[model samples]
Target: MNCESIRNQFSSYLDGELASEQSRRVERHLSDCQGCHAQWLELQQLDARLQGLAVPQDLESRIVAAVGAETDAEQQAQPAPPPRGYRKQVVAAVIGLAAMIGLLAVWLRPNMPPVDVPPPLAAVVVRSIGNVQVRAPDAEGWSDVDGPHHALPRGSRIKTPQRGGCEVETATDAQLRLDANTEMVVHGSSHMQVLRGQVWCQAAPQQPLTLGTRPPADTAAVPDVFVCPAASEMQVRVDQHQAAEVGTEPVRKAWQLPLLALPGSDQGELSSLVETLLANVGHSKMQFMNADQIRALGPRGAIPLLMYVREPSSSQQPAVRRQAMQLAAEVADDTALTMLDELLADPDPQIRRLAEATVERLSVGSAR
Candidate 1:
């Protein structure tokens, strides 16, 4: 490949998200071209530098204070506080100073009223791991998740899946709906851990849900951990070590395309590492997944492409959607077919049409 072509795929190559053929071409060129190799080195350094940047501790505190202030202001705007006994009044007096301070903050702040959004509803991202992943429906049909399995932190939201399906929604109005017979976990606040089952979720805004920390337990038996960030609204599913013949590895790994879209050195290597982690999901889980089973485990194979169809994000361009549809059709299943059929009644005619066409191709393969 030429320099431009090689450069275009540099990100994918670094992320290990490239197709086998593309990976080979880039690897070959990098071997022969010192310039591109040097470019790779620079990219690596840049990633390291970026990753080292830490999120400020004050961020959480500031956000909490902001919310508290907003609440206090609303309370003061009212004539009377909730009724309480004499002892309660005494307690209120002690805390009244802090409330007054919060009230002042609310008056001074520019954002104005702060809505009391629920924690689970505040989830901004929902990720499914282990066994299977699916979504419920929105106005459209079932959406496809492409980009990256780990794309939540990137602000890419999953549109709500169809009704009656196991889907998860995020605070950003994104959704993660699982099809029937699929099993997975939804981590982050509104924390849900799916053990050999399918689930759907809706996230709240302000704090996008992501996989937070997991509750301590005998991980060797569970083999999967889902964490809810403290007030962050992000859900994450971590593969845990379960007692099984699949060795000490988790069943599989799947990432969103956006995570692979990260800029850095060895984007491919890092993706590969995540993939290896998913593939090596500890215990005997690995042995249970056949080739097809492995592919269905995450976005690594065809699942991401399938999930992207319903994604109503600016990032998912038309051409990208078309390409993803083609890929999904190649591995379409009955669940996908049913989901597409339901999507035909979607409010977005365009999405409905796309689902119709894609489902037809998928069903044809099923017939054969």
Candidate 2:
């Protein structure tokens, strides 16, 4: 690749997000090109300086206060508080000042009111058939996605074992499927970096999916993004550090499309690292007392599980939901049960089996 192209990936390379071969290529280019190498060294120094600094404990609170406080313009719009010692000023002066203050406030008040906007949503991992895992942002290790708990942080990674693959859904209902032996780093809900293997994507009937691909060498200029019009599907696979697209195929809905549009909704809440351990029972299923035998488990065990089940934010991982369902029924936790009932309407056989088994188990226990 030329210097210009190589430089385009410097940010990703510095973040260690490049594929092995791609990373090696960049290293080679840096070694051969003095200009690029100098730039790279400078980048490394900047990163080191940034990393060595510690954030103040009140940094966040200070930032929030600064952002939420009235700006200088807003303060000025209130008319200087009548100068404090203006009691001697004539009544006409006071009347004129009041009239001018009202005019200024009306003219300088913001054109738009402050609207409370929620944070951006991300794609969630909804289906997993084999060994899948997700690595949280800035985390030191990868966690096996044994079951459930597939909500993704915007900058996190998801990978699958040789026989494993998973699906992700966006709030817009776009869905993407990762093939086995693939690693993908999601860039928000719409964009992703496919380091290896392939992905299938199907856009929602109304959502036009813009699939971003790695640009090609200078000699072969490729379009940066492919627009899969509403209701279309596409495939993207990595080859030689570039995304090679398979021509759009509108049919063949076997359910694994990484870049196509699919239906989605907001699911799952973000948790602190320690709190994550308690919430992620699906990642450590063995530690969970058998769902069928939770009768001996105390409120300590049951409350977190029930709380997780009832939380508005939850991924649609079948195992986690089913286990929570069992707990809800066992304790007669109507709210948790009601939440599960509403979420379980998909009737996908895998989910149906879980729902059916829960009902059957509950019924048989009552009969005894």
Candidate 3:
């Protein structure tokens, strides 16, 4: 085989996918061509860098159960096999979606760092109902909760809008159930802060739980503090040996704060960075890391970039474009209604549906 043609088949060759005759020809060329051999070696070295892959098993079951729950019936397909390229796309998306927690926690497999490190699990997301979103500690925007979410890192914030509610079991064995219009921040194993809305706390059975409330709730039920969130915040503290204190005073760092200025008073650098990440959104390594960066840029600055990326004119991959649209929904507000309204005409039915939903949500939020 000629150098050009043989190089095109390198991935297939590495995957042991070449036909016998073609594989022999490619092998002959690699042995004789010094440059080709070096290139192949580089590819192998890069492949070896990815070692010790860890996929969270709890995360996997949650995704499976969530999908199983959503589908009302099972239909067997006996159609022709899909194109070879189709499977590649599906695998890429499924594996990389974690980096994309812009699908999950802590953000990578997106809640996690690009490197391998055991993230401290702060709590388990036991239940998620209706529309729910979570923001990783220091994340700039909410990530739509798809499927069952597990292993929330400390300091992550979960919110249930007027329509949704969620439940979590902390490492301390305490259980907290949030009602609609509630937002909560988990402060490690034993501490929790409910910024707003009503929440019922079930202290660890083993601990002498002390529960406190901002205003006051009936703590008559031992180990159970039914927080009547009437103008007061709730605190659930479960100590191994001490009484749990639950009370509401002033809320520190409530979810809504002044929006951050774009990396100081300058917009020039921020604009340039946005363009850079957009152009490289499909790069092998960059695609997995870009979601967090885009979210951190804030919705206002990303409004134009988001429109460009999700537009049919852009060159992003299908997965990347889908991620962008999902992100648009996360940060969407009344200010984004115009762009989302325009998206209503998108040729992709999925995008159109998402845009319609986002618009409705923005309208509702704006009214409030």
Candidate 4:
């Protein structure tokens, strides 16, 4: 590749777009072309510098003023409006239809960023009549839960009841690791509750742990505390005043129902646990809401997660959104489609990509 050609294709080459033949040619040229190499390095440095420049204040206002001035000047230069003509109306209608089709194409394009797609509604399990508990970190060498009573080293899987549940993560020595689908209720200073999920806890005295209603929960049941002394001994109880349990086997089994008393309250806890698991699973939560939920999650919850869906880092948004999207497909309706479209406007790029994928998934599933 010559200098000019290489320069023109520099971005594509940097992005690994060149085919084998072109790639070999570029490699050969780079080996002998010090000047081109220098230019490439300069371009990379320029990119870095440009990235470092922060958005200036009032950028929107400045751009708006410039665009408005241009438009106003153009309008002033134009003569008076011509009389209404059927031909002009027909042309305008055709243009409008074309624009609408173009927008639909953009919405349907998988490669393009998502825009105007609505988010799915949160899933509601009508009745979880039967109960079950399981653990995650199912991948061998990743989980610590071997059985009901055993605790593994850090990063071990705690069992969760639901299929798409959360996992326990251990961050420090005293604090035990929590895995997906795990729930714990703090009975008091003495005993901790495990309602029907998995948790990986270190048996340490100075590190007493309790599971109960946490943040976002209006009330908590009698807190349950899990005690593991330095002796590697463990106990579960509603409070320090009572012995919820003692010994390895019983304690392990009892951990399953830490939140037994607060089943409904466990929803918020479960949601929080899911959020935690998603973060550990290398995801971030972005807020994409329709016109309605935006008001509720905002006014009531005092939190807003609204954004454009096509911006980078949307993937890091809450994994729960994915679950919601699936649920929307199961309950396909105009409302669901509208919600998906609204989410398409989410500012997060990863979210936008996911929203698009979810739309396709729902569509395919419906067709089947």
> TM-scores of the models, in the given order?
0.21, 0.35, 0.28, 0.20
CA displacement after TM-score superposition, residue 263 of candidate 4 (Å): 33
Tens digit of per-residue lDDT, candidate 1, span 170-268 = 433445444334334333223344432233233433222222222336543323322221222232332332211111122122333322334432377
lDDT of 3 at 184: 70
Query: For candidate 3, lDDT tens digit of each residue in 30-115?
Result: 64675775586566444433332356667655655554443323223434555657545655565567644532343335454475
Cα error, residue 108 of model 2, in Å, equals: 20
Best-to-worst order by lDDT is: 2, 3, 1, 4
Highest lDDT scorer: 2
Worst 10 residues of 3 by lDDT: 253-262
Rate residue 30 of model 2 by lDDT.
61
The clash numbers for all candidates, in the given order, read: 95, 21, 23, 77
Writing each residue's lDDT as its tens digit, candidate 4 over 1-368 gives 46999788877755557775675566456545657755765664444434334444665455556555665676688866334573355445655555556556655888986444221111111122123232222334333333232333211223344443322222123333333354553222222345443444433333223232222134443323333432243332222223233344323422323332234434664544443443332222223444344333322221112222222344554454454333333334332444457667776555566556656766776798
Better of 1 and 2 by lDDT: 2
1 or 3, greater by TM-score: 3
lDDT, candidate 2, 136-203, per-residue tens: 77678999775554677656788988876787776557777787788877755545666667777777
User: What's the distance in Å from true for residue 10, model 4?
Assistant: 2.7
Report, for every candidate in turn, its global Cα lDDT versus the true structure: 0.44, 0.58, 0.57, 0.40
